[model samples]
Target: MEREIFPWIGASRGTSILISKKKSFHYTDVIANNSSRYIIVSGIPQHRKITLINIYAPNSGQLVGDPILLGGDMNLVNNPLLDRSSRPLPADAALSTALDELQRLLRVTDVW
Candidate 1:
């Protein structure tokens, strides 16, 4: 995952790229894609650290200003009518409402 990642980015003739905690972003989720899977996150070096969130899981309310490619599995059911579940739970209007509110807050729309 590290080979030829940033062919366009490089240090100046006399400048060197400094790698450190402040120059990168890190995140992890256990229930999204696996029981436990570690993911390496990073941002543009020399810039402020960026925070990334797993929107589908909603671990944090902080939304990325850029378009977020949210993809995950948290076993959450916002719409029983459209979303599938192994054991269907009673549909709650409040849950649906909350989901709508979340989508609006994030300015994100479902693909389907």
Candidate 2:
């Protein structure tokens, strides 16, 4: 059941945006009543490629930055409740931490 539903959902979301193991890629473009964004992922067989994500973060506005990325709609800006570890945290803590780290990282031009 999970396998069956997975493919259907993937297809519905236009996840087949690329092909080839040597240079495969996929992206989703979403447009809502007042917002738009993109999610992209690409790779090669033995090398790390690009994963460009565009998301609307609250208050801080549009943030355009580097390759090899993970981003999403962080609903709050300048919140300090997030954890800074490599491992996952509880949902609420993770959200706050992720936003904090993203904001902090964005400030450092050399880090991106």
Candidate 3:
């Protein structure tokens, strides 16, 4: 599996890749820096290609359309603790915003 790392916001990142198997498939990993919100999208090769997305949202949402799976993480888990005592701490909101933007871009791109 070949991988490519595409950085969006500072420290917050996302990855896009092409996995070679019996058929070629595309994948994207969107990760936030401070939050536990990580979204993944996988595309299967077929006449009617299937797109599967694994999302961790700390809120409610719905899945729309075929070959698309939408989910949320209503409860916050796996999120690192904030260090207010430190010189500076990254904001979770920023990271969450970045991940959201990345997801939108990946969904529209043909490379996915």
> Which regions in candidate 3 have their CA more than 4 angstroms from the true location?
4-18, 26-36, 42-44, 55-112
- Mind giving the per-residue lDDT tens digits that candidate 3 earns over 7-111? 232434332333445565544333434443443454445544554433343333453443544554422212224423333335555664555576687673222
lDDT of 3: 0.42
Error of 2 at 38 (Å): 7.3
Please report, in order, the local distance difference test score of every candidate based on alpha carbons.
0.44, 0.38, 0.42
Query: Which candidate leads in TM-score?
Result: 1
lDDT computed for candidate 2: 0.38
**If both were scored by TM-score, which would come out higher, candidate 1 or candidate 3?**
1
lDDT of 2 by residue, 4-92 (tens): 10121233232222344454333233232222223343333335454443343333333445333553444443333333334443465
Model 1 lDDT tens row, 11-92? 3212112234433433222122232122223443345554332222223446556455766553455676667645556655
lDDT of 1: 0.44
- Residue pair clashes in candidate 2: 82-96, 82-97
Best first by lDDT, ranked: 1, 3, 2
TM-score: the better of candidates 2 and 3: 2
